[model samples]
Target: MPIISKQHGNTLLITLVILILFSILGLSLLSISISGMSKNEIREDNIQSQDLSEKGIDRITHQINSELTKKIEENNGLTRTNFINLLNSTVNKYKCTSGGSIADSNGKTGSYNACIKEVNPTFEKNKPTVENELRKSIVFESKGKSGDSTKILLTEIEIGAESAPETLKYAVGTNINDKDGIQDGEGNLYLHGGVSVKGDFKVDGNIITRNFGYAYLNGEQWIQSLLPESIPSDGSTNSKLVLGKDSYRLTTNTGYNNHIDRNTFTGSTYSRTTDMKNLFSGEKVPKIVQRDPVISPIGITDQKANFFLISGEYYSTGVNKIPISNVNKSSSKIIPTYTERTRECVRGFLICFEYKNVDTEKESGSFEMNGTNRFNQFSTIGSLELTNSNSTFTKGLYVGGNLQIGNNNTTYNSNNYSDITLDGPIYVKGNVNIQGANLKSNVLLYVEGEVKIQYSTINGKPLTDGKQGSLIIFSKGQIKISNNSVNQDNPSQIKGFFYSEQDLEIYGVGSNIRIEGGISARRIVLNAIRGRASDKLFTGATKINSNDYFEGEVGQKTRESRLQIIYDQEIIETFSNLKQPEPIIYKVEPPLVKERKI
Candidate 1:
C-alpha cells in the first residue's frame, strides 16, 4: 500500500466490487443446480416406481394364472376352497420382492409388497345367478418401491359357477363330448315330428341337425332374463343358439373346435369372449340321486306284513324291492316296448293271471298292497310292468331292474288312453318302456338305462301357471320318445325334463311334437319327419306330418322354437335333498380379470 494516484485507487476499488458480485452470482448458480438435481431425482423415482408396479403386477398375475391352469390340469379339478388355498400360497410378489432385491428401471434394486383378499361379488341385480357361490372376487394388489417412492396397482379377478342345466335346472343339458375326447358331432341334436322344447336346451358339444333344429330363445327379453344377460355381445355373433346348417356334413370331421365347419355360426359362445373356459374343465356334473345303500320296502320277502303301505303314506323299502305280481311271485312280463327284459313273469298274460288273486294273493314275507291304494317310496328288485289303466304312482319309486308301463296291446286314446300317472323323484336302475296315450307326470325319472316313450301328452304341472311344474327325466343311457304306428292327430304335448347321458331321441310324425320342460343329452335327435307317417287318425284317416315341415325352432311347442326350456325352482330344490355320492362342486369357468392403479 505505497504511494497511490486518486485515479488508480478508484480503479482498484471498482475491480474489487466486480469480483464480489461475480462470487455471489456463482454461489447462487451452484445452489440452483443442486436443487434442480434433487427434484429430478424424485421425479425419476416416481416414474420408475409406477413402471415397476405395473411390471410387478403383470408378472404376478401372469404367473398365478399360469400356475392355476397347470394345477387344474394336474389335479383334473380344484374346488373353490382348494383354489383359494392355492392362491394364498403365492406369498411375496415373487421371491424377488422378499429382500428388496427386485430390479428397478435404473438398474437399481427395489422391493415390492403384495396382498390378495376375497371381496363380495359384483353380479347383476334381480338376475338368477345360480350356483355362482355369491359371485365372489379376489382383489390383488402390489406396490413397488423405488428411491423411497411407491406405486400401487390393483386388479380384480372374478370366477363364475353354474349347475349343469341338464342334470337339474334345465329341460335339457347335455355334454355330448363326455364319452369321446373330441367334439365332432357326437353331441348333435335333431328335432322332428314338429317336436320342440319349451325350455332352455344346452348342448356342450354340438347340434347335428340335418333338416335344421328349432329352438326359440325368447329374443332380447329371453336373453335379458337368461344367461346371455351376463355375457357381452361381440357384434359378430347373435345371442341365439345357431343350429349350423352344415352339421350333417360336419359329423364326419373327428376333431374338436373345427372352426372351419362352424365359422359362420353367429350364436352366443357364452359371456366370456375374452377367456373361454376349457371343456375339459376338470369338473363333473352333479348327479340327481346315486344308487347308494338305502332303506327301501320294495323287496325283502322276509318282512311280511311288517310295513303296511297305507294309501297316501310314505314308506321305505329297506334295501329291497317289491314284487309287482303275485301269480309268478318272482316273475314280471308286462312289456311291449321293453320285451327284451322279460324273464321271471314270462308266462302267458292269462296264465299268470289265473293264479293271481288280487285279494288273497299276498305272500308270507312280501311287501303287499291291497286294492287301489296309493303309496310312495316303493322299490322293485326286478322288472316291474304296469298294464293297469288309470294307475297313479306318487312320491318316489326305485326299480333295480327294468320297468314297463302302458298297454302294448292297445293304442292310447282320450277315452281308451291308459294314464300311468306319477310324481317326482323316481329312480329306475334299468331300462324303461312305455306305450300310452297321455303320458303325464309331475316327476323326475332318473334312469340308469335306456328309456322309450311311444305316445305322450302333457305330464305333471303346466308351465303356464308361472310355477314350478313339469317332469324331468335324467337317463344314464339313450332316451327315445316317439309315436307308435297307431299314432295320428295325437298333437301331443311333450313337456318335462329329459336328459340322457347318451343320445336323447324323439320321433314324431303324425303328431305335432310340441314339448315343454327340457331335453338334454349327449346327442339330441328329434325326428318329426313325415317320411313314414301317414295321414290317418286311429283308422279315421288321422293327420300326420306327411312331408318335411318346419314350424319354428326344433324344440318348442308353440311360437318361435320347436324346443324350449324354462327354469323351475321346485326341481332345483328337489336336487338339494337328493342322495349324493360325495361333496359336489360344479366346474369353475375362467375368471374375468380387470386391473387399474390404486
Candidate 2:
C-alpha cells in the first residue's frame, strides 16, 4: 500500500511541472504579438504623413495660380490692387514651411516644415506700386524637404518704371524712307507719309512711332491677340464685343452652298460674354451666325465667313445690302482664306498696301495681289472692291483705306494715304506703329493684350481738345505703352489714360490729364506727366497711394481669401492596426518521461 502511495505522489509532481512549462510558452507568444502591433502602427502613420505633405504643396501652388489669373483679368491685367491682394493672401503665409500642421484636401493632418530664404529677382511690375518707381521683387524659397517628405513651388514678382522716349519725328508726309521693315539697329522708327516696304521685314527691337502716322510694319506676322475678349456667357451667335443678326453682317447671306461636308467646319467658339450665364439663366439661346465661314490667319477656320460691313462707310441707315454683287464679275465673291505660315517668332515687321486709284472702281468687291515679288503690291485704276478677300503680307500689316479687320488677325496691308474706313474694329494684336492718318472704327481698337508705341501725333495736335488729352487708352484686358520717340526737339505734349492692369508711365512733355490704373516712375518730370483728364497738367510727380495696401509676410499665419483656418502641430487622435502585425500563435508539446518500475 505504501509503495502505491509513493508512485501516485510522483505522478502528481510531474503534472505540476507540465503546467508551469505551458504557462511560460503562452506568455512569450502574447509579448511577440504586442510588439508587432506597435511597429505596424508606426508604419501607417509614416505613410499618411508623407501623403499629406505632397497634398499641401499642391494646394499652395493652386492658390498662387488662381490669384495670378484673377488679378490679371479683374484689374485689366495685374494692377497694383491685384498684386497687393495676391501677396497678402498667399505669399504672406508660411512660404517655405512652417512648424504647424497643415490639413490636406483629404482632411489628413501632417506636420509642415520647410526652409525659407528670400532670393533676389529682377521682375517687372504690371503696375506701379504705392511707392512710385521701378518694381522690386520679393523672392523666397518655394520648396520643402523632410526625411522622406518633399514639396516645391517656384514663383517671382517685381515692380518698376521704364523710361519713355522724348521726341518722335515724321508723323505725317509722303514717300520718305519706308521705316516699316527696318531693323532695330536702324534706331526707333518714325513715319508720316504714304509708305511701301518690300522685303522679309523684321524688327529685332522695339518699333515706336506716332499712332497717327500712316504706316505699317512688314514681316512674317505672328499676331497674338486677334480677338481678346471672354467668350460670351449668354448664348449669342457672336464671339466678339458685338453680335450680328441672322445674315452674317459682312455676307450677302450666311449660308453654306459648298459641297464640303459639315464636318469640315473647325473654329474656336466665340462668345459675347464669358460669365457662364447661359447655363441656367434666362439668357436666350444664341443662333449661330457664321462670322468666319473659312478661317485662314492662324488656321482657326478654313475661310473668311463673311465680309464685315462698315456702318458709316458701306451700310447706310435705310437698307443694308451684301456687296457680293460688286465682285461677281472678277472672281468668287467669297473671301479667300490666307493661312499664317509665320514661325512662332516673338518679333515681326510692318508694311503698308495702297490702291493707286479708288474713284473708278468704287463698286468692285474683291481685290488680290497675284505678284510673286519678295513683297507683292496690287493696284487699281479706280475705287476697287478689296472686300470679301483675304490678303497676307508676309511681314507687318498696314492699312489706309475703308478697311475692315476680321475677328481674326489677317495679314492684309491697307492702302495708306487714304480716308480709311473700318467695318469692324482694328485689332492691334502685335505692334501698331501708326505714323499719321485718321483712324476711324466701328467698335473698339482692341489690342486683346498688350500695346507698345513709340510716339503719337494723334489728331495731328495736342490732347488738350475736348477739355482733355488727345489720345484714349481703353481695354477689357490690359494696355502698355513705352515711348521710344527720339524727336525730343519738339516733344508733343500728351494726354490720355495710361490705362492698364497696372500703372501708366509717360516720359514726354506737354499739357494733358492722365487716367491710369496705377502710376510708377523714378522721375516723372512733372512737366511731362499729368493725372485726371480734367486735372491740371502734372508739373511734377502726381503721386497717389492706395488706402488698402498690404504686403506679403514670408513666414506667418494668414487666411486664404480671408477665410479662417486653424494651424496646429499635434496629432489629435491615435489608432492601432491589428491586421498589420501577423498573429503570434503559441504551441505546446508533451514532455517525455520514462515509466520505470519502482
Error of 1 at 516 (Å): 3.7
**What's the TM-score of each model vs. the native?**
0.51, 0.25
Residues 368-456 of candidate 1: C-alpha lDDT, one tens digit per residue: 22123343345444555654433334435555567676655344344555555544356676788876545555565667778887654
Stretches > 4 Å off in candidate 1: 1-112, 116-149, 152-157, 165-185, 191-380, 385-397, 405-410, 417-421, 437-440, 462-466, 484-496, 529-583, 592-597
Clashes of 1: 68
Q: What is the lDDT of every predicted structure here?
A: 0.44, 0.25
TM-score of 2: 0.25
Question: What is the clash tally of candidate 2?
Answer: 79
Tens-place lDDT per residue, model 2, 343-415, is 1221232111111212322333222222111212122111122222333222112122222222122211222
Candidate 1: deviation at residue 87, Å?
11
| Decoy 1 TM-score against native | 0.51
